[model samples]
Every structure is written in structure tokens, then in C-alpha cells.
Target: MLSLPATLTQDHARECLEQLTDGLQAEAAQVVVDAAELRQFDSSALAVLLALRRECARAGKHFAVQGLPQRLRDLATLYGIEGLLPAA
Candidate 1:
């Protein structure tokens, strides 16, 4: 598992997505995403999580959001993917 630093939103999201996709293929299991430290986020950033889940499913590996912040939860709820992440 790796924690993504949210400072560089787009880059962080993309890098995390790539790592998840690549790691899942080799690991053959879900890679836990630690979003506890995330301070800020946006649509594109959240989409990476969605894309990761999809990619992991397509690759036959599970993926989950771990230690998500409440702020993120509300945003995800607004985006309709709230259930996808761990509760704050």
C-alpha cells in the first residue's frame, strides 16, 4: 500500500492510478489506497480512484479506498461514488 500526497492533484492522481493498475496486475490482489492524508481533491483526482477500481476489476484484482477523510467522503457522495470508499 502507498499513500498518495494530494498536493499535486493531477500528477498524484495519475501516478497513483498507474501504480495501482500496474501493481494490481502483478500482485493479483487489491492494492489498498490510503487517502487519509488527503487535504484537497477535485473531479479529475476522484476519477483516478474510479478508474483504478475499474482497471483493477478488468485486471482481476480488487481495489479499495482505505482511511479516507470525511471531506472526501462528502465530495464522493456528491459525485455518487461515496460507497466506493471507506467511511470516515
Candidate 2:
């Protein structure tokens, strides 16, 4: 599982994304992104997940999110990206 840090703001998007990518590249099972700690996020934070999903697809791997906060769920829907972060 991709455990998110205490926060997921724009300040750490790149660094966190890199760490996530590293974990993805080394994992044998499906990449499960854990977002339980992502309390508040903006467009940049959203981009990080989108980019990771793209990278996973490019490398032919399964990707799904875990513990997504309601704020994020609403953001995805508001931005027309709910399809990317389906329930569960």
C-alpha cells in the first residue's frame, strides 16, 4: 500500500510522487495508494495522483486508491475526475 504522509499539499507533491513511484516500481502486487492522511488538497495534489495513474498504466500495472477523504472525493467529482477515483 502507498501510505501517504501526514499531509499532501503542493509543497510535497513532487517528493511524495517520487517516493510513490519508487514504491510502485518495486511492488509485486497491485499499487494501492493510501490517502487516509490527505486532509486538504488542491489541484496540484490531484495532479500527483493523475500522473501516478498514468505512469502505472504506461508500465502495465493495476492502480487503485485507498482511504480517500471526502474532500478529495468531492474534488474529483467537481473537477470531472471522479472516474479516476472510483469508490473503494
Candidate 3:
């Protein structure tokens, strides 16, 4: 499982995506991201996850997020993207 940092805002979005992408390349057919540590975040967090999901799709790997904060999940719902970020 790949772990997200405690804070993931726009300021850290790019860096976080790069790091997670690198890790994703090393994962197996199914990639699971742990988002329990993510305490402070913004819409950028969802962007990063969406980008990661796209990467997973291109690589033919199944992608899911574990322990995503409720608030973030709600944000995804508001954006009509909750279906994109599957829960593990």
C-alpha cells in the first residue's frame, strides 16, 4: 500500500503525485493507496488521486484508496467523482 502524507494541499500536490506515481510503478496488478494519514487537504488531493487513477488505468492496474477521510470523500461526491476513487 502507498501512503499519503498528513497534509496534501495545492502546495504539495505535484510533489505528492510524483512520489506516488513512482511507487505505483512498483506495485502489483492492484494498487491500493492508504489515505488515513491525510488530515489536512484540499481539492488538490482529489486531483492527485484522479491523476494516479489515470496512471493505474494506463498501466492496466486496478486502483483503490483505503482509509480516505470522510471529508475528502464528500468533496469527491460534490464533484461527482466519488465513483472514480474506489474504496479498498
For 18-40, candidate 2 gives per-residue lDDT tens digits of: 99888888865477888888776
Give the per-residue Cα lDDT of candidate 3 at 19: 99
Clashes by residue pair, model 2 = none
Worst 10 residues of 2 by lDDT: 25-34
**Model 1: per-residue Cα lDDT over 1-88, one tens digit each:** 7565655276576776777567565553756777877777766667877787787677776677777777767778898888775432
**Between prediction 2 and prediction 3, which has the larger lDDT?**
3
Leading candidate by TM-score? 3
**Worst 10 contiguous positions by lDDT, candidate 3:** 21-30
Clashing pairs in 3: none
RMSD (CA, Å), each prediction: 2.6, 1.4, 0.5
lDDT of each: 0.69, 0.81, 0.97
**Model 2 Cα shift for residue 71 (angstroms):** 0.6
Best by lDDT: 3
As a whole number from 0 to 100, the lDDT of residue 82 in candidate 3 is 100
What is candidate 3's lDDT per residue for 1-88, written digit by digit as tens? 8999999999999999999999997999999999999999999999999999999999999999999999999999999999999899
